[model samples]
Target chain A: MAIQQFEHGKMTLEQFEILLDTLGTNFDSWPKMKQAEARNLAQTLDGKRLFRGAQKLEMLMMALQSTPQSTSQSVPESSSESPLVNSAVTPCDTQKEAFLEKLADIPRRYQQNSAHLTVCNRMTLFVTQALAVNSDGSRLFSPQRLASQAAAFAAVLAVGILVGITPEETPTGSGEIDLSETWFVASSDFELGE
Target chain B: MPNRDKADDTILVARVCAGDSDAFRLLVIRHGARFRMLAMRFTFDQALAEDVVQEAFISLWLKAGKFDGAKASFTTWFHRIVINKCLDYKRKRQFSALPDGYDRADPAVGPEVKLAADGASNRLKTVLSALSERQKTAVILSYYSGLSNQEAAEVMQMNIKAYESLLVRSRAKMRKMLMAEKDDLFAAFA
Candidate 1:
């Protein structure tokens, strides 16, 4: 009883099935020793059915890869409109080049395409999130966002002046009206009444 | 004979690891055709397949120093590299007229391979695209690329059992889909 159960190894039917998912219908690809076990399993009624099913599928896959030359050449039987083209192209002949002519430019093309993509994305941002126009025709930028961004920017400039500008400019007596502080007032005035 | 070739590859891979450009070129030329054909399974377009092969070798050349002879053979390592590159290209771009993109001679290529990549692989690819990513990869590496189950496992970075499990499921799915396609075709004939 134990031998009967253990014939398939510790690999349960479920596990065996999971194994089948990756290996396809071929037992040859199985480990050299296990190939015998796999073939044995394939001989069972269910296994045979599965094998037939997979064979039909495999045949379809093969049909997709290389249609039988006879079938393609059958003319009346074959649906292909141009037998001329079919005869002209053989798999090995076409595969000879291996398509390496465009090799050197791949990186360059990727670089250019990626740059183009980035620019397109940046432009897309302006169209969607950045430039999202509201019901009215005015710019989509909300006052709150503008105000928040302005505040953050002003804080950065303030830190820069006290830490960088003041140290250099203060030591030289070139205070220069502290334009960092006054520019906001001028900008606010410029936006007034509009 | 295969063993000797394998040994030769080991030498070539080592030379490449040592920064020998000529060795790297030889490796490219040696594996280029196979890589291109493998890539063609992923991208039915010959031009795109070549692009995938080109990127694979370029990546291999850049990463030659990382090749660990003890862990995997050169062929397995390089196959993984090429498979990943093909997947990357597929992810980035949408492939149209696949498995059959070679219906006409691409002006870019000379007359040799122009006619077809196995007579319009698109029918299979369209159906194959329905599979999960791992299933698709398994079928391509195992069925299309002709990597043995064990080699395919290495390429997928999965254990033998796990890879087999995946292949089984993939084959089952393929059977179901292909059967459906056949029935559809028959019905059309009717």
Candidate 2:
């Protein structure tokens, strides 16, 4: 039936290649019609070459699976290791142990991050409480709350701008010198000298 | 069986999200070795593979909340993470020296003889490394790691048809490369 389809122009070489890619080179597992069509196609020269290439690919993958894994060596397996890990039977139990040892610190580090976040959260909570129109948390976004939040934001932005524009100065033996003021003073002194 | 694994993974992930380290440990123990093997296929270095797996699991720990089991299986999600780490590692360390005490080919022995003696797996690895990263990934995901085409496509973030097409092109390219070394490969095998 598939051979007839192929012969009748139903299955093109491109479509056959798609099937070959999707279904692999194995004809036996294909649907009966496709199996017949594919087997018939496989007999042709182009089909033969395509099938051979797929077979070689399968063989290469097989060789990879059978290859002696570089990491597989005779190392004692630990008791806590999973059977899935050991099923590969590679001597990676030590590596797994190391991973788990590293994993042990995750919660602590996570808690530390949580602690850091908590401080920020507490600040946010304080500001939120101050902005709250009601203690029961109703009307949290009331007009007054918005005004307060806006004012807080504007104040913070103003402080940031101020800090950003302030010129940095080095403390000398006498004390910190204002470079801008010193320049202005020297210029005035030069004008007076003139 | 897969359903049970999925359920187990879902629960474990939920626990990890709840800050349960023991659940996270179990998850690592169950999947770490296989993940390492997958990484090794990409890096070809045990230590590098370990680092890739470490980075992947660390991301898993830090971003457990991002995973949605309803949309995709945990394994598929984690596979994407590992593959991304492998790709990132490859990009970061594009140039590396040969391992210490590496054996150079003998002047007396022909290249063909040397390749044959190294075995088909090694020769195939050489050919695979010569392919583009996507092609290499297509081969590794489909064949070495035993993922279904659909699953591999999802892991690669490509459509199923595109993944299959990539596999076809990859295999064809590998066959061409092997044929060029036919004297070493086909002759020895034949």
Candidate 3:
């Protein structure tokens, strides 16, 4: 019908091309009414050239879209053949099985993965188990325990403070130096290089 | 026939949700090659296509519980997932260079024919790669993947009219770009 509209000059060439784009080069693929119109249009002088050009473009586009195997298959054959038609055929059995096998292994692998703990999960489980096994769960936070921990923390802090305030004794013998003496070199004594 | 396929897919997905690996495997066997071809059409590299399909299947497994039969058929939903994976792959590798001889010539082909085919394919790919991402997707989904416009629009999450517009613009752009090549193609036929 769009081609009919085009024949009547009611549709533009661009609009007619959209019908070609959608319905494709094969007249059989177009609507029954439109197929007659399209075929009639093709019989016209200009329409003949347009349809031929469109079919050629379709073939070229198919050549661009086809799998590597199909491209080679069409080369020695007629150019009028559409590579799209050839590539649309299902893949061979061996190739199909290879792709299927790759997918078939996924669920089993996923099952195995979820069944086995990850490293982080294992670490968490180990920590929980160790805590449950070694400690009386209810008494882990008793007042006496908290008091003991606090006292230990205070003693450690005190020791750290004492260490910080206490000066180190100077090394004796050849490494000994007088703390009161100053060893200084003036900047003026050095030469400034260009 | 599609309704029967959809019903079977629904049952398989339900079984998958219930922890049936066999059902999952069956679903994989049924749809794997088709989806692989779809991914290959998008990615153009077999290895990358396999990776895309694998990742999509893995997502399907984890998200099977999320599929609502009321919303979309299993194939349409899965097509969305596969297309998204391809789009994401394209985005991540956007800055990387395409490998040498990406459209490799057949060794069995004559040198002259090989050279011509290779040259034409390379030029076509150059023109194709220059298309905007959505235009490329529209062309691939409509022309290459064999999806009906409705199904492709659903996968693309676009209205039918919008999808058709995209297809029209895509064909127009490709036609303009290949005007010179069109002459050669016609001459060959003549």
lDDT string for model 1 (A27-139, tens) is: 78755655676677778776665555556565556544453221112221122232223346555434442243234223334322222234444443333333334445465
Q: Give the alpha carbon lDDT tens digit for every residue of A27-90 in model 2.
A: 8876676777788888999887777766666666665665444233332233255433435432
- The second chain of candidate 2 has a TM-score of 0.84
Candidate ranking under DockQ, highest first, comes to 3, 2, 1
True contacts kept of each: 0.19, 0.15, 0.24
lDDT of 1 by residue, B1-190 (tens): 5655565566565554444455555565455666776777677666777767777776655555566665877889888888788778888988654344445444544543233323235456766788988888888887666569888999899998788777767776777666554444422112
Ten residues in a row with the worst lDDT in model 2 chain A?
A70-79
Candidate 3 C-alpha lDDT tens digits along B135-175 = 98888788666679999998889999899888877877776
Docking model 3 quality class? incorrect
DockQ, all models: 0.10, 0.11, 0.13
Q: What would the per-residue lDDT of candidate 2 be over residues B69-118, giving only the tens digit for each residue?
A: 66787888899889889999989885365421124534444666445545
Q: Please give each candidate's TM-score.
A: 0.53, 0.61, 0.60
Q: TM-score of the A chain in candidate 1?
A: 0.31
Off by over 4 Å in 2: A1-22, A30-50, A68-112, A115-194, B99-118, B183-190
- Candidate achieving higher TM-score, 1 or 2: 2
For candidate 1 chain B, which ten residues in a row score worst on lDDT? B181-190
Candidate 1, residue B169: lDDT:
70
